[model samples]
Target: MPKTKTERVTISLCPPVDLGGEPGWIPFDAPSLVGESLRFVSGEPDGNRFRARYYRDAEQHLHARIWFGPETEGPPGHAHGGAVAAVMDEALGLAAWAAGYPIVVGNLNVSFRNMLPLQKVVTVESRVISAEGRKVMVHGRIFSGETVYAEAECLCITIPGK
Candidate 1:
């Protein structure tokens, strides 16, 4: 009998709070697509492959403590580029929302500086760079201490109604 190879992967994450002590880190509440608060990614019951807790720093920037789990792996032990982009998309878009713009991302540009390791915690920081007419520009980075993993710029457009 031959052993079967499995393509299915299981993801696991350590709580962000256990990684570091975040000051003034408050839970950000955003309307969920399912009419509840945002939960797992792609509606996966196990958990979000990349779990992020949003916050507002003392300087009023949109900040997030994110964990990349095994489910997000792209290369061996590194997280997939799409996973990083997804985190940036949500974080940058949320930045626009936190700035009082009811918005949806029009375009999202991401630059991968380095491969992010799986099962590690990183901080995602975002700021609304500018707002002109319906376009809102947001910049963000994913980093752990001094190492930068990725950076992103998101163009957001205001929704018709809140």
Candidate 2:
């Protein structure tokens, strides 16, 4: 028997929903010196692929709530590894900035534990683990509740000026 084909549907990749104003969390405002040029997760507010909200805990660790939208899919319903890496990169890099270091990532190492489902809200937590001269090391994880999807380490260096 031949299967019937249905008409294709059109979909728009709209921006993710806001997850701000959670209890015991304070919003971390990124510096606007870069103006509108930066294009990653932290730079663009209307980014359709991924949506992230930066926050600081009482202990001052950098944490974020992220939504992996449909546009980031790579394997079936899961998010692309690059998309996941990009999120970790931005979150971990911002951790350095939040800790008062104006820097750029020198190297980013990401380990995928499990595939992340699209359109799901996940939490990213980061800490500045070590600092030596111009080097800053940050560790982070992407998880939903108790399920960890990925972990990353980002080494950042001071951006010479500012």
Candidate maximizing lDDT: 2
TM-score of each candidate structure, all chains considered together = 0.80, 0.84
lDDT for every model?
Answer: 0.79, 0.84
lDDT (10s digit) by residue, model 1, range 80-144: 99989988887888888888888888999999999999888899999999999999999999999
- Top candidate by TM-score: 2
* C-alpha RMSD of candidate 2: 5.4
lDDT of 2 by residue, 1-162 (tens): 876988788766575486674589898775453334236675545566777777889999989998888778999999999999999888888888888888889999999999999888899999999999999999999998789999999999988778
Worst 10 residues of 1 by lDDT: 33-42
Which parts of model 1 have CA positions greater than 4 angstroms off?
Answer: 1-21, 31-48
- Give candidate 2 regions above 4 Å deviation: 1-18, 31-38, 43-47
lDDT of 1: 0.79
lDDT of 1 at 101: 89
> How many clashes show up in model 2?
0
